[model samples]
Target chain A: MSLELAVLDWFFEPLQFAFMQRSLAVAIMVGIICSVVGSYLMVQRLALLGDAISHSVLPGLAIAFLLGVNIFVGAFIAGVISTVIIGWIHTRSPIKEDAAMGIVFSAFFALGITLITTIQKDNKIDLNHFLFGNILGVTVGDVRDTAIIAALVLMAVFLLYKELLFYSFDPLGAQAGGLPTGLLNAGLMVLIALTVVASMKVVGVILVLSLLIAPGATAYLLVPRLHQVMLLGAAIGVLSSVSGMYLSYYVNLPSGPAIVMVVSALFALSFLFSPRHGVLVGPRRGRPWQKLRTLLPSKGS
Target chain B: MATSPKIIVDHLSVNYRDVQALRNVNLTVRPGKMVGIFGPNGAGKSTLIKAMLGLMPVVTGRVTYGDDTLAHQLDRVAYVPQRSQIDWTFPATVWDVVMMGRVKKTGWFNRFSASSRQLATAALERVGMLEFRDRPIGALSGGQQQRVFLARALAQEAEIFCFDEPFVGVDQKTETVLFNIFRELAQAGKIVMVINHDLGESITNFDQLILLNKELIAAGPRDWVLTRDNMTRAYGGHVGFFGHVA
Candidate 1:
């Protein structure tokens, strides 16, 4: 058989399974939304806040299960609460936001673990799936939910592109210009919470931050504008997701981790070879021998 | 110049972290004047501007432009924060930063209009940063960066202009450009308020000075406000300011 035909068969055979189709849909949607939303976090240096929100959603997920509520709603509420507490702690005390996040997320995560470990005895749920994700286990419902979130996130970003850009770039300047900065800030938090909830099934709570930050950070290295970074980041995310899913299919690796590894590799590649800020070939990098000598800080000079 | 209304600051006060940054300060800033807010370090020059723009909560009193509270009419104001307040490495070009000045005027959920683009372009051209429009902001020198921000404020087409520490870390050429623009704005009957710490020859450019040190020490014409008594009161008596100004 021709190599083209073989590749076609390899791709087409995966689509024959309904679960594979659903998993791919969820992965792709999460990729796009995460990249778009994560661009804001990257520019603002709030990447760890993504990690905090993702982990904090756990207690909500456990509560939702206990109350028989929609896990997404519960998880989103929990994410928002975590952010509010982080804000409150940092604002009212000498402790900074990073420390606040560390304290709050760990507490929420511990509670989630206790609740889930206790409840799983009588339920069919698996804790590992929530921790690492089981993309193959995603139902049509998850696909629909993720699609709704992706649409809402993308549309909100589009409509408020200029305002958000101004705010994230320079909050004080934008606020002084009378842009209703408080409302814009609340809107950004909501968008981030929703993205985290939607992405839970694809990357889980612990690994979700990787999806949120890597693609946008990679694109930032290559692009010169926020919009360009977001667009290129979304493209990078989708490509990584699809390729990772295919790799998982052919090689029998775990889907979520495979996807993360692929995106991470892409970021590493960009880190080394991006035309502007890369390590080896960047125009700003002086001669390799001179650079090495400077790092060595010669004994007497 | 006469038609432009004066800004009325009525017994304003501000506190931060349980400490008073500014207190019971009352002053009027007339249009057609280049007004400098002169003070030593940590004297709440920034706090005063932030309070007027309603960027911070006030402890008492109000600031007014025309008949309404100044905060209510912030759309008519353009503010340039200190260079340290901004993230220079942000992923934006000079053109992008300048266009942010037009964001409020352009309104929400809309693309920038042609006239808005024209204003940004004109502002950039005025500041002589038009040639660097496509360069990322992080790549610019300190003076160029300040010039770009000045261009952003100019693009705003605002009635009142407030700049915080605009001269910090800037080159001599930028200082010349900034003073020339301040004079031009004053000549056009606009209110140009700058927070300047320099007591050097540059102090001569201002038509009025607001001397502050946690409280209003003086607020009047340059010669009146920069008197020895007021300088000693505001700067605690070891000031070498008179050397250059004299």
Candidate 2:
């Protein structure tokens, strides 16, 4: 087959399968949502929140599976509960943000593992789909659900973008200004819960952190403005998803890790070459040769 | 806007588990007045402010704003907490931080409007930080960060402003600039309450003083409440740190 034919064949091959087509649609929408909300989480220092939440949902999923319910519903319920509990504990306790997060996540994860091993001994359910998603078998229901939740998350974030930024940086000031800090906090937690549940089916729990953080963090390095960061992050995420899907289809590899690897590569390139804050830019404002000439004073001392 | 007592704290007491952070503190701050709250370490200055702002749960006294309770009139009073109490590494600009002050004014379901931006800019300008509005608040100097907080409070445009040690960890120039801005707010009929550590500076700068040591030691005009006897009572001994008492 010709190279062009191979490329065309790979693209058309996915459309031939209903599951693959649904997965592609779901992945694309999820990529946009994860990148958009993920950028805010990364910037606001809530990067680990997605991981913490995904881990906490394990028990909920195990119970739901044992009870013959949809794992997504189980995970969603668990996600919202855990998010609220963590936020409340962190705010009320003397423990700082990171320490509180660690305590809540570990305890919940340990409980989840225990439940999974003890209660689901029959093991009829394949939990691997939650850890490393099977994009090849995404159902139409999953796509519809993911689309609705992603749209809601996007709307909530954009509507309260100003308040979120404000409260994230200055909670005290937000409270004093009567901005309903507590309510905004709870709303953001709900958004986190929804995002985790939506992205889990695309990137899986293990690799979802990359989907939730890498593109946004990388975009931050490239852009100096918040709006630009969001736009760049979305573009990076969608591009990474498309490229990773193609690479996985051709090479017959896992979709989640492939997407993360592509995104990581983009981050690496930006780290080395971005103009605003790249490692290569350093503290100098000119080319290395120009800087060296200036130091050498051209022909004179 | 009106020349009335905006904040009134009546027998406010805050307990943390077993320890009593504040004990029966009573204070009344009028509009267009600069009230300085001074105390040594662990003197419940921050606790009092927290209780007033409903940030503390184990508080047993009522905090009122003008004719309404603080719980009912939250938007009328503003708080500028200690600069050291927050984590600055969170990603946000000075403008973003100040824009939060308008959150209450704009309410929910709406993004910060152009009017909010105007308020934020004007507040930044009042603090002489108009040029640094776009800078990430974490990237600014300690003084600049404090000024950002001040700008946030200014943007709130609350009738009563409570600052918990804005001068702490700041340069002399920043301290003066903060008080000058406080003076401007007071002149515009806003009640400005600043919790201070420097007794001498408070005595020289403020119009009224609320001396506290886990309780209300003295509350009156600076000259009457800032006496050496009142200092000895509030400090309870040789308050050598900031020379409150010899």
Candidate 3:
């Protein structure tokens, strides 16, 4: 068989399974929203915050399952609460923000694990699915939920692009210019929480940071502006998700780890080969040897 | 726009953790004059501006502008923080940074209007940064970065302007451009206040001076505020005021 035919067969065979179709749709939606919203995290140096929120959502998900409510809603509330708690701890005490995040996320993660373990004894639910996402098991409803989240997150990012850029770049300047920075900050946190909840079903909590951070960081090496970084990052994320699903289907690999590996691979590629800022392909700076040569007397001298 | 409003900081005090940063800092800054705030390290120079702009919580008195508090009228004020407070390595072009000045005026959920872009372009051109509009902020020289920030403030078109240490790490040309624009702004009946650490020859550019050391030591015309006694009070006798007479 021709290589082209083999490629087409590889791509089309996955559509034959309903699970693959649903998981692909959900993956694409989550991929787009995570990267788009995650650009804010990357530029603001809040990658750790993304990890914190993602982990903190697990307890909310477990509790929501217990209450028979929407896991997404519970996860979002938990994520937001964790951020507030972190802020409160930082402000009320001499503890810095990183320490605050560490304290809050670990406590929430521990509670989530304990709750899940206790509930698993009586229920059909598997803790492993929540810890490591079971993308192959995504339902049509999950796809719909992911789509809605993607639309809302993308729209909020679109509407508030300029304001968010100003706030993130220079918050004090934005505040002094009469931009309600507090409101902007709260709005950003909501967007982040929503993104984290939407992404939970695709990559789970432990690996969501890769989806939220790697794509944007990869794009940053290639782009010069925030909007461009977000745009490129979304493309990279979608490509990674689709290709990762394909890899999982063909190689029988775990879907979440596959997606994360692909995104990380893309980041490594960009880090080495990006045109403007790449380590290998970018303009070479003066090396130590060159500096020494310039410092010492020239051969003519 | 008639008789540009004056800024009155009255009996304002600020406490950071357990330390008192500022105490009863009273001063009146009027339009059409350039005021320089000078003091030694840890004298609450930055805190005074932050408190006045309501960026920090104050324990005592308030800052007002005519009938309204300064915080309420922040739309009319443009404040540039010290360079150290900003992360310059963030992925942003000069154009992007300059356009941020118009973000407030353009309102939320709205695109920047044509006139706003024009103003930003004009400000960039005025600062000789139009050619570098597409350049990332991290790639610029220190002086160029300072110029870009000044352009952003100019694009704000505010009535009251406050700059914290604008001259630090800037080239001579940037300093010249900054002072010229400041003088023009002050001459146009705007209130221009700068927090400067230097008491060198550039001190002559200020029309009035506010000497501070956690409290208001002296405030008046440059000569009066730069007296030897005031310098000694503010700087703990390490500073020798130029033109000071024994």
Candidate 4:
């Protein structure tokens, strides 16, 4: 076969399976929503909050499964509940926010594990599937659900762009300027919870923070504005996710970890090569290898 | 813009968790005047301002502006919090920060109108930050950051202007710019209030002084509020004024 034909064949072979198509669609949607919502978390220094929300969703998932409810709604409720509890603990006590988040997430996660373990005895469900996603097992319904979440999240972000930007940048100033800061905060919390719930199947709760933070953090290094960071981060996220899906099909690796590795690698590459704030490249305004100039003999010397 | 009214904070009290931040503080900030809030450390200068703006929950009294409560009419107020209260490293350009002033006026779910852009542009130019509009806020110096915030306040075009510690980290040039704009705002029949802890020569810039120490010590013209008795009362003893009064 010709080289082009072989390449095309390799790519086309995966689409032959309905499962691959569904997983890819879900992955793409997860990628976009996670990055957009995660940009807020990353900027607010709430990356750990993402972890807290993701893990806290497990108990809700197990309970929903027992009660025969939509797991997404349950997961979202749990995520928001965990956030509120974290806030309550931090405010009502001298214990700081980080400590509160750590305590609440662990307790919820432990309860989730116990619940899932007990439920697993009577059902065919596996805890590993939730901890590490089984993306290839996603159905057409998963694709539709993920698409709805992505559309809603993107629309909310677009409509509330200016308000969210102002609130996230300066909460007190936003409050003083008559922005209804409490409502805006609750809206953001909703956006975050919805994003976390949508991302649960792609990276699982264990690895969701990577999908949430790494892409946005990477784009942050390369951009100078919040919207720019979110846009570039979405692009990075989508590319990494789709490529990871392809890599998994060809390399026989787990889809979730493969996606995570790709995004992490992208972050590492950007961390060292970003034009303005790179370690080795220094800055692109000068030269790509400007830092290497130190090793070379100087003309003045 | 014909005549600005006074902000009547009547017997206002505030608490910080358990401790009393401000107690039964009663003062009136008049328009067409530059008012300075001066106090020592932990003297509730910021708290008094916050309580007046309804940023904190009051325990005792009401802060009324005109006929309505001040909290109900926050749109007429422009507040620039202390430099330490903000996170400058967040991803925002100078233009973005200044445009936040228009967010309230433009309303929600709507794009900024042309007049909003014009106001933001004029504000940036007023503070000499028009050239740095595209610069990331985190990349600016302390004074430049403060200037951007001042530009934001100017863009607000509010009836009441409140600044908290605007001079804490600014340069001489920025301080002069701030005071000049403040005086101009006061001349335009606008209410300008600033929280400052400086016992330096700049105390003379304010037309009125509000000396505070958990409560209102003295409030009136500069000389009247800077009496030796008031100073001793507000600052515990062994303290000096700006050499303008005993």
Segments in model 1 whose C-alpha atoms lie over 4 Å from true places: A286-301, B244-246
Listed in order, the DockQ scores are 0.88, 0.44, 0.83, 0.82
User: Candidate 3, which segments miss by more than 4 Å at Cα?
Assistant: A286-301, B244-246
Rank by DockQ, highest first.
1, 3, 4, 2
The regions of model 2 sitting more than 4 angstroms off are A1-17, A85-124, A284-301, B171-173, B239-246
The C-alpha RMSD in Å for every predicted model, in order, reads 2.0, 4.6, 3.5, 2.8
Tens-digit lDDT track of model 4 for B37-66: 998899999888778878888889999999
True contacts kept of each: 0.84, 0.56, 0.89, 0.81
TM-score for all models, in order of appearance = 0.96, 0.88, 0.96, 0.96
**Tens-digit lDDT track of model 1 for A1-301:** 9999998998899999999999999989999999999999999999999999988988899899999999899999999999999999999998999999999999988988898899999998778888888888999889989999999999999999999999999899999988999899889999999999998888788888888999999999999999999999999999888988999999999888999999999999898778898775466777656655665767975
Query: Looking at candidate 1, what is the lDDT of residue A102?
Result: 98
Candidate 2 vs candidate 4: the TM-score winner is: 4
Q: Report the error of model 4 at residue A105, Å.
A: 0.9
RMSD, candidate 3, Å: 3.5
TM-score (chain B only), all candidates: 0.97, 0.92, 0.97, 0.98
For model 2, how does the per-residue alpha-carbon lDDT over A160-248 read when each residue is reduced to its tens digit?
88777767766776776677778887787778778878887777877888988988888888775566677889889888987788788
